[model samples]
Target: MSLEIRKIVSFEEETLIEGYKKADRPLRMFAVAAVVTNPWAGRFVHDLKPVVREYGPQLGELLTQRICELAGGAENIEAFGKAAVVGLNGEVEHASALIHTLHFGNFYREAVEAKSFLSFTNTRGPANAPISVPMMDKNDGGKRSHYLTLQFNIGDAPAADEIVVVLGGATGGRPHHRIGDRYQELQELGHDVDNPAAV
Candidate 1:
């Protein structure tokens, strides 16, 4: 499939803490989302649940790698935070299936264990998911597309200080922006880049 990635969406440092507070967790957490396009999503015009189920682990691995890179590696993630996978538009069902699959669930557990991060939580939003839609169609041709957003919280990693990594993208294709690049942009916007002490 010819996948196209649009952009990676992340929460600002100030907002990261806000999200952690919203989670009612004692430790700080960073929330990040990845928006990507599934080039084959609309082409098939059928439920892609099977493909998602089979590839969920791969997708999770990619997400974990991206998060690690953004956090400066596994050591930078706090030991008590949550991560989420949010989907939009045509991705609702497929994204949900991916996270709910057996292999994908195991991958998440392994990631947390290996990284020494706190707990991991997986969630999904449908066509009108709560999180902002990070990708848009330039053509606006009513051509339905699938987008995946990955969000995570950085609890108390020294390297994270006050930074949370947010990355998201459309699946089936490369993203318009890299997670690291987006983080830098957020920093330039004067987002609270200092790591906050655990709540």
Candidate 2:
């Protein structure tokens, strides 16, 4: 099924610090959102896979490209994530149907060559509802410093029978990450940190 996109929204944020001191470079985050009609709203569909499969790749490409552009370029994006919010007339599953599949997610992953799966959220909400997208290191999901969340809201969207789909990107991790890396934590524990199954 083809998605009927009503409008698009974009958000950007720059964080400079966690405490008193600020870093030389600010951490930049960007998000791209699409407001679209929900094809299966107000009813239950026994099968959702086909619907998702049909539209996933297109949505992934479109959203990813937009966010990458907003952030300067895909190569500059260090972390990534996605989210969806369904309107009151639609169920949460309607949000899930558009985002949870690799058919859509893998496109973004491959575009950025991200190793970790895209972090995500799916829920039901009304216009002006807050939307949060949690991002992880594009190459190393275990990097705690790279974990971040970008939040925003559309002033007018998801007006029942609609869904808001978002894709987020970051140019860097937290500016002043002094907590140390995950590998260092594993090392201090004196465990087989290199073994994938041992942890």
Candidate 3:
């Protein structure tokens, strides 16, 4: 089956830190999302593992692009912060995807080149809540899955404060057609949605 990519939920220009405070260490947070279709969901695909493995890296790249764009470009984010990736439900495995995307970082210790400086917090819950669920088997039958919400935190950065970015399916993960469809619905509802290029 064909897969659709969408921005189900997102946060834009959200200042993780209110005002600049003089401290030895400071924290910044930001949130963003890229809900991808399972491609093999509800259907049997022989190459599921490989497909997920491949798409994981692509998703990471997309997320990094969104983060950089949110920071106003590559030259803006200073290398002085920590970041986090928040998975909506099934997106927790995205951590592996991120590691794959930043594989070059092992050779070069730079966030810009890595295109990502955020760590991932693998948790399960509703996209809008802070609760979590125990890990489950990926091959369980008659089960439902949700999208992942990647969150980033920048600590002690001079150019910017704390930021939080969340990425997940707009429909909260119950086969709502495509990921971007929910985002469109939210936009039409006048929810403050931010574009990838927003600063």
Q: Which candidate ranks first by lDDT, i.e. highest?
A: 2
Extract clashing residue pairs from model 2. none
TM-score of the candidate numbered 1?
Answer: 0.40
**Two-way TM-score contest, 1 vs 2, winner:** 2
Model 1 CA lDDT for position 37: 51
For residue 91, model 1's alpha carbon misses the true position, in angstroms, by 6.6
Score every model by TM-score: 0.40, 0.92, 0.40
Which stretches of candidate 3 lie above 4 Å from their native place? 1-3, 12-28, 39-48, 79-111, 114-118, 131-199
Tens digit of per-residue lDDT, candidate 1, span 12-113: 322223322442322222344444454333333476565656556555566666655555555544322333334432334434444455454455345444
- Per-model RMSD to reference: 18.2, 1.7, 19.9
Better of 2 and 3 by lDDT: 2
lDDT of 2 by residue, 121-181 (tens): 9989999999999999998877988899999999888888899999999998888777777
Report the poorest 10 consecutive residues by lDDT, candidate 2. 190-199
Model 3 RMSD, rounded to 1 decimal: 19.9
Please give the lDDT score at residue 7 for candidate 2. 95
